[model samples]
Target: MAQTATRHAKLWFAGQAENWALAAYEIDELHEGMEDAGKYHPTHKQIKQAIPELIAQYVDQPLTALEQAINAKNKAEFIANYDKLTAGCNACHQATEFGFNVVQRPSFNPFANQAF
Candidate 1:
């Protein structure tokens, strides 16, 4: 989950930087990670059940919105919803009592060697 979240953030940052290709790749990865985590992780069912309906929507909604934005090549909408997606992630973390793991708009890529 943490890895996925970090990748999501990186991708969101990439989108903000207008690196659409990297953003698109990361978005796909984030979706896959979300599905995998919900289905096969040890805490799978528990995690799913614990997610409140609104939070669940937060998870689903932004994913769809981000995909649309990417498909349309809409940078402005992508950035806006990217922030929403980041907020949703942090909100879920806080709701799950992982507030200390707050995610933010990344200022720098941890993967410095990777060009996005």
Candidate 2:
């Protein structure tokens, strides 16, 4: 159960990173990956039920920072802050003793329609 939770947490961060990268770049293919992560993420329930709402209450974050950064047209800022958010995801995973999975930055831009 602990390891499972860790995987879920890891997936959450990866998906969140993908989400922000896609949004910032306006890439449809990366966005599609993010969408898939959303659908298949392991922690979707805990995120909606506990983790996210709790963070929104206690911390200054919960991945919305990426959305705001992108909206502000600060791609550099988005990338910088995105590292922290992605780190948090890995932290949660490690805390749960599931350090096998490591999330990484997106390498290929898959947006078919628009350029960022």
Candidate 3:
């Protein structure tokens, strides 16, 4: 889950850099991550099963919008949906009693060796 969230943040960074191609690639990766999570991420499966409504509303829906914006290469809509995605993540955390682990649009690259 942390890894997926980190990748999501990186997607945001790529979008912020106006690197739409990179952002699109990362969006694909993020979607794949979610798919893998559904299959293999135990906690993800648990929460998703327990709170289908929240997951659908916050996580799935926002990610679908993000994907659409990325596919369209609409910078403005992409930015808007990125914010939605961030809120969705935090909303999930809060719903699951992990609100202290606040996810934000990262201010710096957490990857020390990678350039954004």
Candidate 2 has its poorest 10 consecutive residues by lDDT at 51-60
Q: How accurate is candidate 3 locally (lDDT)?
A: 0.78
lDDT tens per residue, model 3, 2-47: 7787788789888877788888888888877766655664354335
- On lDDT, the candidate that comes out on top is 3
Per-residue C-alpha lDDT of model 1 across residues 1-116, encoded as one tens digit per residue = 77886788678667767777878888998988877665654353335443435346557788889988987879989988888888888777766667788777776667776666
**In model 2, where do residues sit more than 4 Å from their true spots?**
1-62, 109-116
lDDT of 1: 0.75
- Displacement of residue 62 (Cα, Å) in model 2 is 5.3
Question: Model 2, 29-62: lDDT tens per residue?
Answer: 3334434444555354334333433333322353
Model 3 TM-score on a 0 to 1 scale: 0.80
Q: How does each model score on lDDT?
A: 0.75, 0.47, 0.78
Error at 68, model 2, angstroms: 1.6
> Each prediction's Cα RMSD?
2.8, 8.9, 2.7
Q: TM-score per candidate, in order?
A: 0.80, 0.45, 0.80
lDDT assessment of candidate 2:
0.47
